[model samples]
Target chain A: MPEMVNLKINDISVSVEAGSTILDAAKKANIKIPTLCHHEDLCIAGNCRVCVVEQKGVNALKASCATPAEENMEIFTNTNKVREARKTIIGLLLSEHNNDCLHCYKNGNCELQSMAKDYLVDSDKYISILKNYEIDRSSPSIIKDDSKCIRCQRCVRTCAELQDVNALAVSGKGSEMKISTFMEKPMDYVVCTNCGQCVTHCPTGALVEKNYIDEVWDVLNDPSKHVVVQTAPAVRVGLGEAVGLDAGKSYTGKMVTALKMLGFDAVFDTNFSADLTILEEGTELLTRLKDKIENKKDVALPQFTSCSPGWIKYIEHEFPDILDYLSTCKSPQQMLGPLAKTYYAKSMGIDPKDMVVVSIMPCTAKKFEANRPEMYSSGYKDVDYVITTREFGRMIQQAGIDFETLKDSECDSILGKHTGAGVIFGATGGVMEAALRTAYEIITGREVPFSNLEVTPVRGLEGVKEATIKIEGCKAEWKFLENVELKVAVAHGLSNARPLAAQVQNGESPYHFIEIMACPGGCIAGGGQPMPVNNNIRKKRTEAIYNEDESLQLRKSHENPEVKRIYEDFLEKPLGHKSHELLHTTYTKRKKY
Target chain B: MTEINIVKDAVKKHGRKRESLMPVLQEIVKQENYLSEERLMEIAKEFDLSSAEVYGVATFYSFLPVKPMGENVIKVCQTIVCDMKGKEAVLDAIKDKLNIVPGQTSADGKFSLMAVNCIGQCSNAPAMLVNDKPYINLTYENVVKIIDEYQS
Candidate 1:
C-alpha cells in the first residue's frame, strides 16, 4: 500500500492514500466538491474549473480534481470565498447554457441542473458574453448543442481515454471553449464509435443521446397497437440500476415485469435473436470454410461479425471497402425487430402495421439504427421504437412502479427463448465464443471437445486478441501448407479498432475471422447503460452476464429451438436467397465532413 | 483499412439523409476542398430533396464553404490556439499579403481565409491547417512563408 497523507478539509482532519488528489480526499472526508469534467474512469482534465477550492496558503483557488493533496495542507471547502467562486462559475455556465432543462432529455437527472440549484444561481451574471453558437445535429446518435456546453471536457476525456476513440476534443478556449472533432465534423463522419460514453459523463445537456422516447410513447399509446418490447441481454444486468437497484445485479425477472407494467403486450428477449444471429453467422462461416476447402468460388474472406450497430456504422463509414468481410447478419436488436413484425406477428395473428416492436437496449446508437432505411425487412418498418435501459428505467419510475418489490417473471415465448451463447452477447469476446461453439460443432457434426467451451484466444478485455484453431481432419490448407488453421481476432473500442481495421484495409491482416464491438467490454458497458459504472461495477456486470451464460441449459447458438425453427421454416438455409433479401444489406461510400 | 471504409460507408449512408445536409457538406468539404454544384445536386437527389434546399442548408451553416478551393485549404486557428499564440499577428500578415478578410478568397483564388475555433493541437499553439495537414508552432513570418509555397 502507498504511504498516507493527512489534510485538513474545511478544518476537519482527514487522512488519504498518498498521491490522492484533493478532490479524492474531499470525497473520502464527505466534503462535497462539485465537478463536471472529472470522471473517475477518465484522466483528470481540469477544464470545467467548477471544482475550484481554496488552499490556505495558496494565493489563488485551485481545481481540486487535478491538484494533489500535500501532507498537512489546509483546504477551505465551504468558505465564503469558495462559495462565491462556485456560485459565479455556476452563474456563468447557466448564462450560456440552453436553460431548457424542463424539456431536455436530461431534465431532472442532469448534473448542471442540480449544480445550479446547489449554488442557488438565479441570475445570468455573464449573459452578455454568451455566444449564440449553432447547434450541430449532424449525427444520429449524438446531438452537439454548444449553447448548453460548460466546456467541461468530460466528453472529450471519455472518448479519448476510456474508449480509446479520440473523437471529441476541447476546441477554442475561455468563453469560446467548446468540444469538436477534426475541423468540427459531424460525429457520424468522424472516428466516433457512437458508444454514448460521453453522454453518460456529460454534466450538462450539451451532449446527450438523441432521444426517441416520445416516438416510443406515441407508438405505445395507439389504440390499434400491439406493442412488443424486446430487451438486450446487457439491459437485464443493469436496467435495475436505473430504478435504484444496485449495478450488476441481474434484474431479468424484474425487468420483464417492469416492461409488462409499461403496457407492452409482450416482453421478449434479444438473446433469442442473438442466438439466431450466431446460428446464421456460424453457419455462414462454416459454409465459407467448406467453399474454401473445395475451391469452388471466391467466398468473402475473413468474415467479420456484424452484431454491433456501432461497429456496423463504423465499418460502413471508416472501412467501406471491406464490406465483403462483414457478415450479413443484422444485429440482434435489428434481427429481433424484423422478426417481431413478421414472424411473431404472423404467429399472433396480428397485422404487421399494428405491431409495434420496441427494444430496450444498452446502446444509444440503436436509436439511430432503428430509423435506418436499410433496417426495414418485412415490407414495413422493422423496429417501431428504441429506448435505452436508462430511458426504460425512467419510464418505470414515471409509472410509479415499486421496482424493489416487483414480482419476478420470464420473457414471452417465441421471440424470448435463447441459449446461454445468446446471453453472453453483453460482454466482450462473447460473440466470438458463441460463434466458435456453433462453428466447432457444425464442422465436426458433434459437440466440441471441451465442455468448458472457453476459447482463451478471444476471452479477455484486450484491445485486440488473436487465436488459431486447427480443424481435425480438414484438408484445405493454402496458408499453412495442407493444414487448415482457423485464425481469429477480437477488438473492442474504435481506437483500438482503427489500427486493426487498417491492417485489414492494407491487406496485411492474417486472421481469417474477426469480431469487433464498439464499446469497451461490449454491451455490458454500452453507451446507454447506467451512468457512473466504475471499474468495479463493470466487472460485476460482466461477471453477471457470463454467470447467466454458464447457468443456461443451452450454451450454443445451434441449440436454440427458435433458431432451428427459423432455419426450418422461413430462412431455409443460411445465406440463402430469402436470407439475402431480408437479412443482408449493402454499404455506401460516405464523405468525410 | 476497415476503419477507413467504416468512415466512408457511414458518411455515404447518413450523407444521403435530408437532415444530414450539414454533415454531408462537412464530409464533402473535408474530402474535396469545397462543395461543388454537382456534388450538391447529387446529395440533393439522393435525399429526394431540391438542390435549392440542399444549397440553402449548406449556406446556412458557417462551417460549410461553397466554392471550389485552392489545392490546399489553410484554416488558421483564430479562436484560442492562435489567440493565445498571437493569432492576430499571423492573420494580419496573411491578410496583408493575400488582401482578404477571414471569409474572402484571394484575388487569384489561391487561398481562402477562414477562422477555425481550435484544432485540438494546443500543445503546439498557433496552429494552421494546410488542407487537413496541421502545422503548429506558427509565427506570423512562418505562416506567410508556408502560404507562399502554395501561391502557384
Candidate 2:
C-alpha cells in the first residue's frame, strides 16, 4: 500500500519502503553497518558517527542511520575513507573514555569494546584525557560511572522518550558536558524510579546494575547459613539469553538445576507468590467495588496493581495524589521474602536467622525495594542479596557450570509450585488476565469466558489495552445488581501510564481496575534483563511466556495447589490479618526532583 | 517579592512554552545573578517539565550558572587569542589578589573568578569581564587594580 524506494549499496540493488533509512536498505541487502547510539527501542540519535557511509556524488559522508534512502542512490558501506573516519572517531571516543577494561563490569559485553576490536583502533595514538569522576554507587540498584561515558546520549534519550522520567540529563556544555541528575546530586537522593533502563541501554560501562555476586557467593559457602533462592516468572525466559541460549526459550528446569548446583539449599519460584498476589489483590478490588456500590462509600476505583517496584516508586514521586488508588499488595518478590522467613522456615524447622533469602529477578528496582526501611517486617531484612537475571547467569559461568548440559530439575516443595496464571505475569497485560481468571469466577461462579483460558484482548506488546466483561448470572449472596459491566485497562511503560494516572487523579476514569508495568514488555523486557533489548527480543520473550502458560497444568491462580494450601494452613483468607501483616505495605511520597 | 515569586514572574513574562525556557532562565540570571535549585524547581512546576530538564537547560550555557556567585562575577577569557597574549599571567595575578583560583569565590564574597571561552574581543587580547563590563587589553597590574576596585 505504501511507496518503495530503490537503492544500491556496495553495487547491489535493494528496494525498501519510502522513508526507510539507509540502515534499513543496507540490512535488506545483507550489509552490516555497525552503530553505537542507534537502538531499535529508542528514537534515532545521530550523535555517534560510527554508521557513516559514502553516497556517490555527495561531498560529505552521510550518517546512514539518520539519512533516508532515496531512489537509485549509490551508497558505499565499507569504503576506505568511511573506515578511516570511523576508526578515528572510535579513537577519539576512547581518548576520553576510561580504558581500564579489566576493572569494568561490562568488559566482555560492552558494545564499544566490540567496535574497537572490530576496527582495531590504535588506543594509544591519543593521549588519555579521561576526567576523574568518582563512581556514584549511592543507589542500591545501579552504579553511575561518568568516567567511562562516551556521551552517546542513548541513556538520556531512553530516560526521556521511553520512560518519560527525565531523571538523567546532559548537563553543562561542550568539553564539560556530562549526564547528571539535578544539581549533580546522588542518584538515590533524586526522583529516580531506579528502573535501570539506562543501564541496559548504555553502550559502555557507564551505567550498570550494582553487583551482589560476592555477597551471594559468601552466603552459599557459609556452613551455618541456609541459602534459598527464588526465581521470578520473567527470569526463566530471560536467563536463557544471557547463557548463550536464544530468546523465546524457557530455562526453568535448567535454571533450577543450575541454582541447586550453585549450592542453594532450596530453589523456589516467585510465581507461587504471584498466585498469592492474585488472591489478595482480587479481594481488595472486590472490596473497593462493594464499598463504592453497596455501602455508598467513597473508595479509590481503578485500583492500580503494585507488583512492580519501579511503578510503585514512580507513582510515589510523580503521582503522589494517586497513592490511595494503588493496591496495598507487596510485589511477589517481597511477599515471598517474609513468608520464606516465617512460614517456610518454621515449617521446614530452620531458624529464621540462618535462612538467607535471595531473589533472582528480572528487575533492578527489586534491589531498591528490598532495601527500603520498611521492608524489615520479617524482623530481619525480608529479602537479602537481590541479584538480577544477568548476575545469575554470570554466577553460573563463574561456577564453571555448563548450563546446556545440566539436566532439568524440579523446585523444592511448599513454595515451589505455581500456575499458568502466575507465569504470565512476565508480560504486560498478564496480571489483568490472571486477576480476571479468578475474580470473574469469584463473583459469578463461572470461569472467564475465554478460549483455553487465554484473554486475547489483553495480550501482546501494546502500550495501553482496554477490555470490558459484562458480569452475568451472578450467585446471589445479596445481589446489589446483575449484568454490570466490569471494565479494566492495562498499560506498560511509565510514559503510557502518566496519562492514565492523570485521568484517575482528575476523577474521570471509566475503568474499575488498572494494571501498570514500568517496563516496556513488562518483567520479561525489564531493565535488568539481558542488554540490547529490542522489539524482536521483547516479542520472543512474550511468546515464550505465553507458551509457558499453555504448557502448565493449572491455568488459574486459585487452582494453584500451593496457594490453596497457604490460604488454608497459614493465610486463612484473602486480606486477612496474617496476610495483611506480611503481604501488603504502604507507600511514601517523594520529591518530584 | 520572594525568590520563588521572581521565578513565577519570569515564567509569567515569558509564557510557559518549551521555547520560552531559555528566555525565562536568562531573565532569572539577570535578576538573581545565578539560577538556584529552588528557582529551577519552581520553573519546572510552572512549565510542567522535570527539574533535571530545567537544570540541564540552565547549566548548558556558561552565561547562566547554576551555582551561587559572589557580588560580582569576573570571567577571564581563555580563548586562543587571550591565551596567546599572556592571559595566564593575568589569571595568576587575580588569583594572588583574591587568594582564590579559577572556579572559586573570594573569601570576602566580593568576586568569583572563572575561565570562560571567547568573549568576542579578539582584537583586544587578554580581556576580562566583571559583571558584563569588559576591560580589554589587560595586564597583571590592570587585573589587580580591577579586583581592588571591585573588592571595596
Candidate 3:
C-alpha cells in the first residue's frame, strides 16, 4: 500500500496519500475548495490562484493544488484571507474579461461566470483593460474568442496532453500572454483537427463549438422542408447528462420523443449505419487480408478504422504518406447522411432536395465532416446540419419541452433499427470487438469463442489495447491448411494513436487490423458531449454504453434486420458498387505541420 | 547561408531535444535579428514539434520577435527602475529620430524601436540596448547622438 499522509483540513483530520495535494486532502475532509485552473483531466496549472488556502504559521497563502499535503499540516480552506484573495483574483480576471455574458455562446454553462457569481466578484473594482481580439470562426466546428479568455491554460493543456495536437499554445508572457495558434493563423489554416477537446475543457467562453441551433430551428419551422434527424450511438448515453438526468443513464427513447416533438418528420438512428459500417469495413479488411496472405499481392496490411472524422483529419495531416492504410468506409454519420437523402427519401416518397438531413452527434468534427466537398455523393448535400448533444439539449429547452416527462417512443422505420454491436460503437474498443464478433463467426461458422460475445479484452478505458485471435477450423472450398493468429490493436485519443501510426508508417506494425478514435474515451466522451467531462464521467458513460448493448436483443451487426434488408434489396452486398458510391469515401493529404 | 539553412544548421549544432530549442532559436535570432514564420516552421519541423509550440516559445521572449526587423534594432528598458529614471523621455527621443514608436520598424528600413523588459542594467537606472550594446544613464542629447551615429 502507498504511504498515507495525515493532515488537518478545516479542523477535520484527513488522511491522504503522501503525494496528494492539499486540494485532495480538502476533498477527503469534505471541505470543498473552489478552483478554476485545476482540472481532473489535466496537470496542475497553478496559474489561476483562486484555490489559495491558509496554512497555519505561514505568512504566504499556499496554492492548494500545487502544494502537497505534508504530515501534521494544518490547512484552513474557508478563512477570511483565502476568501479575500480569491475574490481579488476573480475581480482582476474579470477586469480583463469582456463581461458580455448576455451575448456570449457559453453564457449559461461557463465555469468562470459561475465562479464570479459564487464569489460575487465586483467587476468595477478595477478599470476594464479587455483587449479587442477578432473572433476566429474559420473552422466550421469551433470558434476561438480571445476577449473572454481568462488564460487558465486548461485548453492548452488538453490539446497538448489528451490529443497530442498542439494547435493551441500560450503566446507572449505576463499581461500580454494569450492562447493562440501558429503565427495567430485562423484555426482552419493551421493543423487543428477540429476535435473540440479544447472547447470542452475551456473554463470561459473562449472556445466553443460553432452553433447551428438557429439553422436547425429554421429548418424545423419551414413547412416546405421535411427535416429528418439521426442520433449517434454515443448521444443516447451522453444526452442524459445534458438534459439534467444522472450520467450513465441511457435516454435513447426519450431523445427520439424529443426530436419528434421538435417537428422532425422522421427520427433515425446513426447506430443503423454503424451496423452498416461494420459490414463494409469488415469486408474491406477481409479483402485486404486475402490479397496479402492468400493472393500474394502487395497490400497495406493492418487496415485502420475510419469512423472518426477527427482521426481521419489527423492522419491526413500527420501521416499523409500512409493514407492507403486507412479503410475507405465513411463514418456512420456520413454514411447515414447520403442514405437519408437518397434511399430514405425514395422509400418515403419525399424529394431528396426537400429532405434536410440533420445528425445529432457526440462530435464537433462531424460538423466539419459533413461540410467536406466529398460528402455531396447523393447528388445533393448529404448531411445538412450537425449539432452536438449539448446543442440538442438547448433546442429542447428552447421548445419548452419537459425532457424527463416525455413518454418513451420508438424510432421511425427504414434507417432506425440497430443492434447491440451498433450501440457498443460509442465506446473505445467497441468497433474492434464488433468486427471480431462477426468476422470470427463468418470464418469458422460458429459463435465467437468469447462468452456471450463480450470480447472483454478489447473493452475499457486503456489508451491502447491489443488482442490476438487464432483462426481454427476454417470453412473453404479448397482449403490451404491454416492456423493463422490474427492480431488487432485498439487505441483512443491521438496521443496513443501516434505510436501505432508511426509503426504502420515504418512498415513495422504486427497487427492485421487497428481501431483508432480521436477523443479520449471514445464517442461516448466525445468533444461535443455534455460539458465537464473527465475520467469519472467517461467511465460512467462507457458503462452505460455496455449496458445499452446488453439490453438489446440483436447483439451482432450482421444479424441486424435492417442491415440484412439493405444488402438484399438495395446495396446488394458489402463493398459492392452501390456501397462504394454512398458508404465509402477517400482522404486527402494536408500540410504536415 | 540562407535563413532556412541557418535554422537547419542550428538544429544540427544543438540536438533535437527540448532543451536545444532555446539555443536553436537564439542562434537564428542572433544572425537574422528576428525570427520569421518560415524559419520558425523549419525549426519546428526539424525538432518534431508543432509550429504553434515553436511560435509560442519565440513570442514569450521579447528578444525573439516573429516579424522582420530593420538593420539596426534598439531595445529600451521599460522596467520600474528605468521608468522612474525618465525612460519615457529616452523612448520619445528614439521615436523622434527613427519616426517610429515601440514595436515598429522605420520606413527607411534602418532602425526598429522596442520597449522591452530589463536587461539587468538597473544600477544604471535608465538603460537601452542598440544592437546588443548597452547605453546607460542617458538623456535626450545622448539618445539623439546615439541614434545619429547609427543612422549612417
Top TM-score model:
3
Q: Which digits, one per residue and each the tens of the lDDT, describe model 2 over residues A1-593?
A: 89999989999999999999999999999999999989988899898999999999998999999999999999999999999999999999999999999889998999999999999998579998989999999999999999999999999898998789999999988889999899899999988898988988999999999989999999999999999999999999999888878898898899999999999999999999999999999999999988888999999998999999999999999999889999999999999999999999999999999999999999999999999887888888999989999999999999999998899999998899999999999999999999999998998888999988889989988889999998888879526537789999999988889989999989999999999999998999898899779889999999999999999989899999999999999999999999989999999988785
lDDT of each: 0.78, 0.92, 0.92
For residues A380-422, what per-residue lDDT tens digits would candidate 3 score against the true structure? 9999999999999899988999999989999998899999999
Cα lDDT tens digits for candidate 3, B1-152 = 56467987898899889999999999999998888888888899999999999999999998998889899989999999999998988988987887799999999998988889989999997999999899999888899999989976
The prediction achieving the highest DockQ against the true structure is 3
After superposing candidate 3, which stretches have Cα over 4 Å from the reference? A477-481, B1-3
Error of 3 at A380 (Å): 1.0
Q: Per-residue alpha-carbon lDDT of model 1 for B54-125, expressed as tens digits?
A: 555565444566666765566888766569878887788788788877777777767777777777888888
Off by over 4 Å in 1: A1-20, A24-32, A54-56, A69-81, A122-129, A133-138, A161-169, A181-193, A293-300, A445-451, A454-457, A467-485, B1-152
lDDT of 1 by residue, A134-158 (tens): 8778777788888778777788777
Whose DockQ is higher: candidate 2's or candidate 3's?
Answer: 3
TM-score of each: 0.76, 0.98, 0.99
Error of 3 at A472 (Å): 1.2
Judged by lDDT against the true structure, how good is candidate 1? 0.78
Clashing pairs in 2: none
Q: Candidate 3 versus the native: TM-score?
A: 0.99
